[model samples]
Target: MTRVRVGCVHLLIAVSTVWVTQAQMGFVFPPVRIQAFSPRGIRVSVPDVEGITALLFDGNINKRIMYDKGDIHGFVTTKTNDYWVLDDPTVELHSGDVINYNVLLETGRFENSPILNGHFKSQQRHVVFNLERRSPPDSSLTVAESKNIKCNQSVTVVFNNNTPICSGQIIFEEDFGTLKEDVWQIEQYIPTEDPAYPFVSYQRSAVSVANMALHIAAKLQQTEPGFTSSSLYTFTLDLTDGCTGKMCKKQPSGADILPPVISGRITSKNFAFKYGTVIVRAKMPKGDWLYPEILLQPLIRNYGDTNYASGIINIASARGNEYLVANSKDYGRHVLYAGPIMDLKCREQLLQNKILVNKSWADNFHEYSLRWTPQYLTFSVDKEDWIHIEPGARGLVSRFPDNCTDLPRERLASSSELAPFDDLFHISLGLAVGGSTEFKDDLTTKADWPKPWRNSARKAMLNFWKDIDAWYPTWKQPELLIDYIKVIAL
Candidate 1:
């Protein structure tokens, strides 16, 4: 009985081994055969076609392998002929454009329908589709409009994306290839989430070619996948003499009209109406003392030569100036803090009634919105309600008393009238330096000097040397860096 049981077990093991061998050597899935250009008539209207290589992979394969070569390459585009390859068998046709295979195996004849065994390309694998081809999207885009303008003209460009393209930035060049254009003033941004205009303007302020190039270059790239090549983004550009609506014909002596809008660079500038409230959304640099300003030029000539340059008002509490509301002379003014609870109605005769800086003036990108209707002036940073100045409310006064005339609370309130703010002019952005001529001594405290004022004084000294030396660096090179500047007209 023992011999009989042992013999039965041995027989079962032999049968199992035979079955496994047969499975491995038997039915094998065939390599997919791509029927050349369907005779039944399927047409692909690819404009440029040259070295196009087509690839396919199995859904279950550890990695999608290409037959052309054995490396990962982005999707294929052709300048002349479309390239094709037979990869996996039984591919799932998606939109007749992409194919995903479920089974991949060597070709062989079986009793009936070919099947893939448990065998795979490798024993252990990370299932990422690996491609092999030439390079990616060539650094060239179709030009929808190219005209030399003598006067400012509203230029419109409509792009047709037929294939998936890498998210790229725009650049402006002159003479078609002499690095960047001489003078191209423009602004642009992706109209993806918020409705804001991305403004790109040439910096007459920059002295270095490298620094100016950095400011002029707009770099953008796609970090997401699966975006089809046919998604088109449009741009509407208007060109005018810088600061003036008047247009010039042919690239002006100092200003040129035909500037390249390359990928990853700021687009040309677009101005809003003078009375229109300006919303500046910026990506702020670091530090607690940096009060970023969005410099803007007035649509109309500023109130003539009155040291009062026209711009929206910005409230800064830390850099020596605290914009506060006057409740009483006996009582100290209210100090505005971070968050939405802090709101002050400020209307400074010396400053415009607008939120001049974004909420992100110190840290991350923040949205700074200023509402300037005929009746009320509201300022918000990062969507947090900060302050509002009503038409009949007390105007913004200097934080510190200076040579400027001072007014008593009750008497001044009755006599003060809100100045009619009409146009916006050159948009300037800089930090408030303590010793700079722009600073008002009225807000400085001899007591606060040892702490906050001391810090400002130090920063001011450093800034002075930096600005002077920046023009002609001896050892260290200066860089022109601006993450982004946006303006909205509503």
Candidate 2:
């Protein structure tokens, strides 16, 4: 009796399980199918897949689909083509389900986002189905609408079109404390990369860079959707306290001190010596939001203490230690702009020592070239005259002849000019982010700083963290594109 009862219970359980399985499998999804699209009208048909849940039609042509999961995430930008099949990702069918779908062609440039030009028609129009596409129906959403960032907090801004900034950092300053009386100091640091680290290698070093080229590019889509629209700026490269004329002259023998070029691809082995022009081309992202940068720093000796003074020299003009070189910037996207060599002619009287421009650089690439030779030095844009230094110009180098160590009378025989322009006579490429560092924001180009303020802030900054060794190093990959460098002997 017990064996029979147990057997009967097992049979009932198995039959109930089968009934539930069939019931679950019986759920049906509507399917819509399209025959073909033409200029005339639309045709419809029944879904051909069996056990199907739904039917979908992708009729938009040239539509790009960005996917996150199995579903379509968004649309990609297209240039000339329209009419694409809208991508659909969520339809799984079984053996016996059927659907019918048709499409209608679109004509002119429709203003709708996703710009739908086609329509769909199905045989069973009353059936409810979910629309399976990424993004809303409207496609005209600007970068601003996509990201909800406040403008005041945005530090890094991009210029795509007439759109507002979409992405940036909002530095929430957490005040620690001020330790000193005369000087207000904060001990906390962001622990970020110090830009002052010594540059180790460069692909190319040239005398000039091309003006009309792409300098930097950042793929913003994968980043914070905030860079959809940004403004671009263009500024003429300038160096303060620059050297030129007799004050800025170099000997042909001193070419060894020029920055060494390490190349494995070309037969030139290194940057070749040049006599005509010294142009330094660099690139920055185009548009008003990006800062166009050109910096030329002269080599100066650190006299240990009591002397934080440094003199400027022209690199192309100096033949030995105490040389100075002007650097230029040319915007290129992973490319180098070829330019002319430089010559620095001695000048007698000086007018202005710096090149100043007040225009904004946007979209177009620019070449900032400094032409220096034995006879004259000219600052130009794409070879156009921007500023010039005449022969035998007189300035600080002449007033402080004792301060100028490169002169024949000032240096001892042991202090050779051939000293690898490494320590006291070399130049550096740097961007100044003025905060509390010795580099303050000089909006007026002021010549002197208040003695107390300078001592308290600038002196303290240099004392605490000027040397590359003093600060921690942080590695960063920039967005600038660099190409092969060329050094020709003029």
Candidate 3:
């Protein structure tokens, strides 16, 4: 009788010994077999099993064998009484090699057993196992490299084989390459008084494009035999030179003073858009009394018209005085100004002013963008941080000050119907010097101007202009670096 016993270590423990008899020679006892058995003196086919096992007894079977050169390498076995060697005929094996094999005893269960080593000599038993390696995670890959990425815009990437790895699009872009004459005109007009900085004088010579960037520089120029920093202009008309009628009078000697600092300004006079996204990537100059501005101006400069209320959008402004008063440490140097400036009553209600309190405007290049639509306008820095303003939101009205009022009842309350902004507006980029009284003392009344807060603002501005030479570095580069300007229809 042959007996076999198999049990899990965690379940049961039983022992059974098998006795074999040779009938022809009388009774013959055989020792219990736990190891594999192979037929003696039998030459097996290449990659064919040479060994077989009847019953597995104690622990799981783990076998490691060394072989000489052979084509038969891997192995497979069924516990019912058969074992088969497996191999790929295409792969050749070398001699004197070590191979490890782990075999599970149960059909569906495997044992966590350590590997055991053994020595085997066979030239035909050596084989190789074919396995494919997996790729690493996507997070391990670097960012895509692309050359078409414009300033403030996204870009896509393609592989060397012309297969696209990633994708991006640029709607509108201007590199200021050699100044597209049809799209841009150098502003030649000098304002009698600038709305933001009244003391600034604009000059036409301050604007230029070189090295693929728009350069607007503020330099110390000789104006009226004195050295001063003034802004450049796009349009300048001598009011006294063109008039010949009785209504014309001789202009004052200092009435049309040349701007002390000559800087550059360019305007898209012929090209204007109603609603779109505008992006300007630029680096600001460093110094006191300097102002770099990116703005949108209405085609018609009238206050009474419907477009006037929404006409002006101050996308980016870096005023030295504002930076000094706000103290770049407390408030950031970037400022956004939006609202209806034509009427004081409407201005209070619609004014959407905010200071970006995080980054330094003059330290490095930054992408300043404005997303303008008929419903609302959004200002953003690097397209990450944003501020949204809806023109007709009554919640924006101010309730302070007994005499203050909201937008007029008869006026169109929504941004789409507002004048100035409703019409097409040309873009303007300029750098000016000095401070404007428009923002002075928070534009408060005389009584409020005497407060300590107002006093500190005055002192800051006074100190800036008093030690102008100390604050303004004459040798340093005095130009704003504009990498590109882009506009995309919303």
- Clashes found in each candidate (C-alpha, N, C closer than 3 A): 66, 89, 41
The whole-model C-alpha lDDT of candidate 2 against the native structure comes to 0.23
Would you list the C-alpha lDDT of every candidate in the order shown?
0.27, 0.23, 0.43
Ordered from best to worst lDDT, the candidate numbers read 3, 1, 2
Tens-digit lDDT track for model 2 on 1-490?
A: 0010111121011223332333344311212222222211222222222222222232222222111111111222221111122322333322222222222222222354322322212111111133222233233222443232223222221111112222222101111111111111111111112222111111221111232221223221112222121100111111112211111121112211211111100111111121223343333332111121232222223311111122222221100101112122212122211211111111111222322233322223344455434334455545466566433234223323343333332222233221111122221222121123222222111122111113224233223222223121210222232221211112
Could you give the C-alpha RMSD of every candidate to the true structure, in order shown? Answer: 24.9, 26.9, 29.2
Among these predictions, the greatest TM-score belongs to 3
> In candidate 2, how many Å is residue 149 off?
59
Worst 10 residues of 1 by lDDT: 1-10
Query: What ranges in model 1 sit over 4 Å off?
Result: 1-272, 286-291, 297-302, 309-312, 315-361, 393-418, 424-426, 430-489
Candidate 1 vs candidate 2: which has greater TM-score?
Answer: 1
Candidate 2, residue 397: lDDT: 31
Judged by whole-model lDDT over C-alpha atoms, candidate 1 comes out at 0.27
| Best lDDT among the predictions, by candidate number | 3
The C-alpha local distance difference test score for the whole of candidate 3 amounts to 0.43
| Winner of 1 and 3 under lDDT | 3
